[model samples]
Target: MCFRLSAEGTVLSVNRYGAEHLGYERNELVGQSLLRVVHEEDRPSVSRRLAECVVVPDTTTAWEFRKVRKDGSVLWVRERARAMTKPNGEAVLLVVCDDVTERKEVEQHLLEQRAQLRDLRLELSLAEQRERRRIGAGLHDSVGQDLAFARMKLRELEAETLASETRRCVEAIGQHLDEAIRATRTLTFELTSPILYELGLEAAIRNLVDRMGAQDTIRFTVRSSGSDETLPEDLNVILYRACAELLLNVRKHARCSEVEVAIECTEEGIRISVQDDGAGFDAGGAGKGSDRTGGYGLFSIREELQPLGGRFEVDSEPGRGTRAVIVAPRERTAIADAR
Candidate 1:
């Protein structure tokens, strides 16, 4: 629809469609200030642009603003206007307008949907962490305690001067119970480490490496350097889990005897890298082929970090060692409350 406005922004004339769209007759709108329809918040900008158009006659300018109808409803409109002078030396504006309200609404809806999805993803990640903590607590407090009691009972029986064969059986039972208790404790730690919440990411990573190093199978070394500041609890959990998963992959698949984990804080963010002297697989085929480490562990780490605007990368080749890096931003909204 097209309309003509005086240099002063009064509506000189409007086409049939333009007048109808504003819920006014062409005659009813004549001589009315254009600001009558332009949304109040946009009037100042529209006024300034119109003034500019007058100063630079014949120059075309484009803008989008909300226009209110006679019925009091508002609609978004895109306007392209050019300034011109009449034979009588009076300046005027010729404007072409298109209603863009529907398009604007659709764009807003899509933005809202994306935001909702992000919130949902963060919430689910936090919920999973909370469940892990609960399961870990249960294992340590219930099953672990029961196994400890059983070991104590066996030791008590051993002190009762039982027969040699019976004593031998009791001792064996006590040993098995001890192993069970140890296994339960290990499983509990795997479910969730208290150090993660107690001390922070660095200490948690160190504890994890130390516990695994105790097995005497894989030689694990951890090096860290940074401001001793703690990270947000949620990010701390993510980094710790990523490191744990990468190290586990090394222990299980890497035939190499040595693994190194390094963490450092830089101006950009935190950098964590896990490298191992183990048989490495094709990095390109990771998460695609039948590689064990390329399965859920790596995929999950990538998925979890994405919402936080963090990044995960792996570099490896056949017969060479694999190095996995995770970089997390220093500032992010905390998902810890979701737990």
Candidate 2:
């Protein structure tokens, strides 16, 4: 479609195809202002482009905007326009337009699909956290209580005057119960820590580092800056899990003995870093499920964080060190509350 417009944007002539496509007769558009067919919101920009053409004669300008047809339907168009001088020296705009509605619709559709996927991922992560909390609570309240009661009864029996051999047997059983109780507590923490829900991400991370450090020869340290008062409950759970996964990877792969986890709240959002001075691997080729790192765990964290306006990054090299950082916006989005 093509049109010839005067310097003031009045249509002097229009191609038959362009006029008919807009549901107008050639004579109907000849004396009409071209802005009549431009979408209201796009008219201002169209005017500016016209001025640019007049000021820079022969320079072509390209842009995309919506145009309205005679029947009030809208269509996207990619227009290329240039200013030219007629034999009388009057300035005129020569414009060509191509329909781009299909491309625009496809782009919008892809955006909606991406949003749906992000919502689905966040929903799944929340559901998993709920389940873990339920199981952790059950272990702490039910089976843990039962074991503690049994141990108390066995101790009471031992206190009674009995044969030394019988007393020794009771003490042995009590010892076994003690170990079972400790194991249950550790398992509960592993599933989901109450600290994460109660004290926020910082304290929960400190507790996690302490617990994991106690179980291994590695030294773990936690440093926190900025206030976590604005961190949402759901984010706390997600970030805590990511940190745990990164630390686990360090324990399983990094041969270094010292690891540091730092949490800071900055202008952008919350930043969490876990650095391990251990056997590092080539991080360049680490894909979704790489054995060098936590593989699926790292991949999953990246996927989960993206939906929350967050990112997971890893920097490492052979014999150097591994630094894993999780950066997330402090605000919990509407999707996080959808469930």
Candidate 3:
């Protein structure tokens, strides 16, 4: 459809097809205001764009807006318009419109599907966190407590008189029990650290780095800033997991001795960076099925963040080092309250 409107938005002329398309006769559309057929909700924006075209005269401005037909049905149209001088020494807008209702409908459908998928993923993450907390609590309250009680009873028995051989056997059993208790505690912390829920993301990360650094194979340093408020619980969990993943990849593949992790709050959101002075590989080729740095690979980590309004980036060069950064959006309007 085509239309020629005066600079003041009066419809000077409309093509035969354009008039009939709106259920109007050719003559009936002449001398009408162009805004008459525009959807009420879109009129303001259409008016603004028209003013812009008049200001920038020969430049084409394109946008999608809703137009109302003669029968009062709305139609989505992709419009392209340009203002130009007419032979009568007046300015007019030459407009071309294309039907885009089907495309618009498809786009809306895709957006709804994406929203549904994000909600489902959030539900699953929350469910998984609850399960982790339950198991961690059971390990601490049941098995851990039981083991401690047994150790205490063994100590009480040891205080009594016993033969040398018997005492030695009891001592060995106590040592084994100690090992078991330590292992259980480690597993519990890994499953769900109370520090993460009690403290914020920065504190939890510091604890993780300190614990890992104790191994002595790698030296880890953590620095953070701009973390004045606590993040949503579910968001913290995901951010924690992503940071842990990067650290694991460094431990397993970087083959370097020093690692640095930084957490900061930016205008966009929270940013976490993990850098290692280890064996770096070709990050460019890493996307082409190469993943020397394992643990959900770099590409997989990026793909996972895309749906959560987050970003994962990696910079690396062979024999230099690797730096991985993850940014998680600060908003939690769609997320439910933490359990």
* Model 3 Cα lDDT, one tens digit per residue, 1-339: 999988888888899999988889978878988899999999999999998999888899999999999999989999999999877778889999999999999999999887676567556766887799889999999999999999999999899999999999999999999999999999998898778888878888889898888876899998888972657777788788778878888888899989999899865689899999988988887744359756457665665466567888889999999988898888865565322
Off by over 4 Å in 3: 4-13, 31-36, 39-63, 70-72, 80-96, 158-161, 226-230, 253-257, 265-271, 276-331, 337-339
Looking at candidate 3, what is the lDDT of residue 227? Answer: 71
Check candidate 2 and list the clashing pairs.
Answer: 255-279, 256-278
For residues 261-337, write the lDDT of model 1, one tens digit per residue: 99998665799999988888888877543465755467677767877779889999989989999999877664543
Report the alpha-carbon TM-score of model 3 versus the true structure: 0.73
Order candidates by lDDT, high to low.
2, 3, 1
> Which wins on lDDT, candidate 2 or candidate 3?
2
Better of 1 and 3 by TM-score: 3
After superposition, the stretches of candidate 1 with alpha carbons farther than 4 Å from their true spots are: 1-119, 214-217, 227-229, 266-268, 285-292, 334-339
Clashing pairs in 3: none
Clashes of 2: 2
